[model samples]
Target: MLAGKRVLLIIGGGIAAYKSLELIRLLQKAGASVVPVLTRAGSEFVTPLSVSALAGHKVYQDLFDLTDEAEMGHIQLSRAADLLVVAPATADLMAKMAGGRADDLASTLLLATDKRVLAAPAMNVRMWEHPATQRNLATVLADGVRVVGPNAGEMACGEFGPGRMAEPAEIVAAVEAALGAGPLAGRHVLVTSGPTHEPIDPVRYIANRSSGAQGTAIAAALRDLGARVTFVTGPAVVPPPAGVAVVRVETAAQMLAAVEAALPADAAVMAAAVADWRVANAGAQKMKKDGSGRAPALEFAENPDILATVSRGALRPRLVVGFAAETEAVVDHATAKRLRKGCDWIVANDVSPATGIMGGAENAVTVISERGAEVWPRMAKDAVARRLAQKIAEALQ
Candidate 1:
């Protein structure tokens, strides 16, 4: 999405400063040339040589370097790029920006820049919640500086809260959004992922082998295309992608509710492996052996058909896609499922033991629609996701 853009990246001081290197690589891969600037404190964490090598440019450090001043002044340097990105935007740096302090090259550039600026804040939880920092945040936001994340999680100090810097991929999404790139821009897509667990009891439950790899890849691909994604996920081995609104659920009924709440979307991809049944007469405590040599009788109840519900709902999206993981009759079953579910399309795949697709990294899918079934070659799940995202963009367009 960032084909011809130039980005000015400022690496600030913090343990998270190391992520700036990955950010540089991602920006470069997205077709943007990066001009890196390292702050004095930032230098202590990552060397200028490392940043320069990754960015493929000289790392700017001093505000008053005579040679740099002779070639391109700070003002020119500030306005040179289309956007300025501050990674590991320390509390101190944010305070400086808010108070109009220009004691260093990084702050000076931020002050002189006429271009858009995006900051990724990273700090201790208490410091982030501090009144001074909050006030600074408010001031910078009022000044029209874009911010990405300080996601809640465990910290380097053995503490936990919303003080972690956003992952590199998340920052890239924010950049794409800021630049207004990608075909899916201004579009909203809902994605359901993972396998739901139907509780037989508090400790034991019925589950599946789904790793959520495909679904996670799909969400990331959609985000990269500039779509605002709402990811409703079940308990799975894979982690949800960053830069998307995530709603986590554990049962088919809960997944359906989350999907409904995320309504009015342009499109929806139902990729979750929701269990078909639940124990209707589950025991309050763990079921114990009675020594009768007979198993306990458990009644089975059907789970909510999420795809069908969405397709027939009043707030149905423009396009509804479902997934069918079958061990037999994959094509025939998927084609019938498309009609039965009333969805626009169904992506069917074989997940038999021999296929190794149940929890594998690769996928071979057959996309069934009213038109016909189109078989796709087996490939990495990520590649499949990118292709599907592109198709969704085209369909939406």
Candidate 2:
């Protein structure tokens, strides 16, 4: 999608700066010409020689180089690219951009550029969550600047939360999405993700091993295709993709509420593994482990089925896709699920412990529609998502 595209990459100073090498390579492999502008702090982590070697071009690192200025002025340099991308966007750099401080080459280019700018933030979790940083992020978003991760994960610091920059491949996908002509442009898509929790007590809950990778991938793919995605997700291991609206929930009831609120979308993908039952009378406080001779018996109640409700709603989506994770008779069960849920299609995958599909990178799935079932070979979750997004686009057309 990026063939013949010009990507102006700005590498910021952070531990995650190393990933920019791979990012440059990926962009070049995808036929993109990369022009790298390294910040002074960015030079401390990765050498200019290294970036120049990988990009196969001279790396620009100054705001006032006589030779550079004589050839192409800073204004021309800033406006030369189709898009501006910042990897490992440090907290300091983000704050500078938010406050319009163009003290250095990178920040100056950011302020001078008229092209769309995208950033993948990397910082300590605390730093990312600081009130100042939060305010800066809000300002950047409000200004129509596209931001990717700063995803939640174990950080270089011993602490863990959302502060990691997205992987190189993921960032490349985001770049392509930003630059590619959106196939589903101007469309709104609603997607649900993760395994809904059913609380039994304050300290205990029932849930499944849905990492939400598939759902997150689907949302990203749809965004790549130019769709405005509203992601209603449960407690997902992965963060929602960039440039999309995310509504977070934990339980089936909360998921239902979120889904209902994101109504009238062109399509809905019910990819969440919602719990079928919840405690009839959940304890408000932690249930003590009393030394009772007899075990406590708990009552169970059915939870709302989000897919069925949406499929049968008055504002029914034009395209409705559900997921069926089964251990046996995958195709049959998925077909039955499509009929039972009244959805237009069902994506069936074997999540049995033996298959290692859940919480894993690769997936083998069969997409069952009213026409028939089409089994896809095992592939990366992102590939599956792209294929599904294309299919959805065709269906919408």
Candidate 3:
């Protein structure tokens, strides 16, 4: 999708700087010509020589290099690319950009550039959540600068929480989404993701293996296509995309309520693995293991089907998509599910224990519509989401 695009890649100083090298390789593989801009501190983590070697171009680092400046002024250099990407965008750089401080080459180019700029922040959890950083992020977003991720996870410093940089592949996809043709602009898409938890007690609950990756990806992809997305997600490992309205819920009932609230959207993608059943009468406190050796019986009640509910609503969306994850008879079961659910389309995939597709980086899906079923080749989940988003855009047209 990025073929022939010129990417001005600015590497910042952070532990995640190493990922920039792989990002360069991926960008080039997708037919993009990368121009490397290394910050002074960025040079410390990854050498300019290494970046140049991977990028297949001379790396630009000095702002005062008279020879280079005379050949291509900073103003010209800044506007030379289709997009400016900052990977491992440190807190310091973000602050500078947020405040319009152009002390270094990277910040200077960022200020001088007219092209769209996307940043993937990498920092400690505390640093990311600090009021100063938060304020700066707000300023940049208001200024039309795009932000990708500082995903939540274990940090390199042994501290666990948010603040990890997005993976190279994810960054690439974000870039494509940013630069791709916007066919879904002005469209409103609502998506549900993750596995809903049905609590039996304070300490116990029922859940599934859904990581919410696919659904979140779909939301991001739709956002990239210029659609305003309302993402209704359960407790998910991955963070939702910026520039989208995110509604968090924990149980199937909560998810249904949130989805209903986000109605009148152009489309709805029900990718959440909502619990089939919930505790009939959940206990408020934790159940104690009594000395009596008898196991307690738990009563169950069926949860609402979010997809079917939305499909049958008075304000039904123009297109409704649902997911069916099955171990056996994948296509057959998925096709049956599409009819029963009354959704316009169903994305079916096998998530058996042996496949490891569930909560994995890749997926193989069969798209079932009113016409028939079509199986897709195994690909990254993000790619699958993009293809599906594009299909939705086409259908809308």
Candidate 4:
């Protein structure tokens, strides 16, 4: 999506600055032109030569370099790129940005840019969580700047918390979400994900084993295509992708409500493994056992069919896609489901334990439609999502 685009990368000083090298590689791999800007403190971590070599563009460092100024003024340089990215955005750098400080070339360009900016923060755990840093973060976010991560993990200081920078791949995804051809641009997409829990009691519930990886990946892919995505997610194992509106729910009923509320969408992808039933009469408190040998019987009630409801609603989206996780006759079941649910497409997958697709990392799907089914070979869920999103773009267009 980023092919032939320009991204002005500002490398900030920190141990995490090293990851910026991989970030540059990934950005270039996506066909984005990289223009590097190294700060005074950033020079301590990575040599300008290294950054320049990887970016294939001269490092823009000095605020007063006569040669650079004569060729391209700072304001012109800021207006030249499609985006500005700050990897390993230190607490100090973030503070400066929050305060609107433009004392150096990096800060000046940040202040001067007319394009959107994405920051991947990297700091010590305490520094990241400190109230001051939190305040600065809120400030920057309020100013229309998007932040990727200060993911939780072991830092170079041997401290473990959310101060580590996001991986190069995750950062790349964030970039794609922010700046891409966005074929789905100006389109609103509603996506549901994960397994919905049907509460039986305060402590017990019925649920499925949906990891939500595929749905999360789909949302990211759609965002990369420039869709304004409303992600209606259930209690998910994986975190929701950044830069999308997330409405979290725990039950199928709640998921349905959220989906309905995000109506008039261009497309809807119902990927959640919503439970088919909930307890007819759930206990308000924990059910205690008396000294009886017999067990209590529980009555079942049908759950709200979120996919069918949205597909058949008065405000039905232009494209409605459902997922059929079947143990046998994948294509047949999915084809039937597509008809039964009144959805445009159904993604069929085998989850018979041996397939390892229930909560696993990869998937093999057959897309069932009115035209027929198309079998897709097993691949990572991310690849499947990209393919699905592209298909969605075509369908919507």
TM-score per model over all chains: 0.65, 0.69, 0.68, 0.69
Mind giving the per-residue lDDT tens digits that candidate 1 earns over 41-68? Answer: 9999999999999999999999989999
* Residues 1-397 of candidate 4: C-alpha lDDT, one tens digit per residue: 6898899999999988899999999999988999999999999999999999999999999999999999999999999999999998999899999999999999999999999998999999999989999889878877878777666668899987668887888778778768855578789999999999888799999999898988988887788668999999999997787678999999988998899999999999999989999999889999888879776689999988888898889999999999999999888888888889999999999999999988886789999988899999887686688789989999989
C-alpha RMSD of each candidate structure in angstroms? 10.1, 7.4, 8.0, 7.1
Pairs clashing within candidate 2: 152-162
lDDT of 3 by residue, 144-174 (tens): 7777666666899999765889889878867
Query: Where does model 1 exceed 4 Å of error?
Result: 1-5, 9-66, 69-178
Give the CA lDDT, 0 to 100, for residue 26 in model 2. 93
Better of 2 and 4 by lDDT: 2
Q: All candidates' lDDT scores?
A: 0.90, 0.89, 0.89, 0.89
Q: Candidate 4: give the clashing pairs.
A: 182-225
Task: Evaluate candidate 1 by giving its C-alpha RMSD to the native, one decimal.
Answer: 10.1
What is the lDDT for 70 in model 3?
A: 91
* Positional deviation of residue 196's Cα in model 3 after best superposition, in angstroms: 0.5
